[model samples]
Target: MRIVACLNGDRRPGAHPALPVSADQLAADARAVVAAGATWLHVHPRDSRGGQALEPQVVTPLLAKLRAAVPGVPISVTTGLSAEPDPWRRYDLVQRWGALPDAATVDLAEPGAVEVARLLADRQVALEARLGTVQAARILTASGLADAFAYVLIGPAEPTVAQALETVTAVEAVLDRAGVALPRLLHGREQTAWPLLDTAIAADRDIRIGLEDTLLAPDGQEAEDNAGLVSQALARIAAHA
Candidate 1:
């Protein structure tokens, strides 16, 4: 099970003081995670004010810095509609991305998921299909895109550990029925993060962690930074291994 380091999400500066907002900060975090055993990297580029931005001008520089910092690590960026509401505009932004990422995520629950998947596939970027519900899994399966996309099964952040496990089981059953044999990356946010990782480790699924998922460590203390989070996750995975 590989560890995908989500360098940052659409998280604001107030989300975590150590959250990487600028390209330089992100690049440094990327290096630290890679050194600590992260097999993949995911990031959400930000504008000057730290808001999520999908335009080429904002994304390219951040991606370039990350690539330079982490050398051959597979880097990906999110194409979530929450970052840009207009579906057509989201498509256009991805099409014009200056420095292409190794892969990009297309939330199956999003509005223009099919079109965005086609666009990314055409550009030769691997697709990481983010499936939140059984319905999302069925939708992607019916779209004839399952064979080409990896899957992300993220449990909700709010639920109790038992509820979260149930959610993961339901999604996994849906994907299994759909015959989704592609790579599966499982994760959760906020309070569910560590428990979900524990579940993923036992299930032998690829897992992701970083400030994007939670601000706290497994011991319930705040993480010093992304590197600390990655380190703790790696140790947990090692214990399981």
Candidate 2:
């Protein structure tokens, strides 16, 4: 099982005081997380104005800095529609990705998911299919693309521990019924975050954590930064081990 660090999310700056917004800050955080034993990175690039931007120019520089800071670590970017609602515009940005991240996550529940998956395949980029619902998992499985992308078994942003566990079980059941088998990463957000991560560890699955997922540590204390989150996550993984 590997640990992925999600540096910054599509969330606004005020969402977390430690969320990295600038390119330099993102690179710095990348270094910190990598040093803390993160196997991969998931980042949401922001423009100079501090808004999520999918433009190639905006994405390339930031990714370049991260790549330089943490050489050889796989980096994934978000292609979710929350930042750019227009599917065509999102496609265009992906097409124009001058410096591509090693992988990108596409929510299967979103419109144009299959198209984005195909585009990623065409470019030889790794795809992580976000499974938000059972229906979404079924859609990905039936698309004949399940074998090509990794699965992200995501739960509710702030569900109870029981709800999060049930969500994971349901997703696993769907995948089993679909006769699908692929690498899977499990993650949840807010209150469900650490609990679900523990679940993932027990299940022997890859897991992710960072400011995008939670602003607090397992002890209910606010995280100081992305490194702090990674350090705490590593500690959890070790405890489970």
TM-score of 1: 0.96
Q: Write the per-residue lDDT of candidate 1 for residues 1-241, one digit (tens) a residue.
A: 7798887787877788889989999999999999988999988888998888899999988888988998999988899987888999999999998689898989888889899999888888988988777677778779998777755546454457777677678877887887778878788888888988888898888999999988999989999988999899989988987
Each model's lDDT comes to 0.85, 0.85
Error of 2 at 87 (Å): 1.1
TM-score of each: 0.96, 0.96
Candidate 1: segments with Cα more than 4 A from true spot:
151-158
> What is the C-alpha lDDT profile of model 2 across 29-130, one tens digit per residue?
999998988999999889888998889988899888988999999999999898688999999889888787899998888898789889998888888888
Q: Flag clash pairs in model 2.
A: none
The alpha-carbon deviation from the true structure for residue 53 of candidate 1, after best TM-score superposition, in angstroms, is 0.7
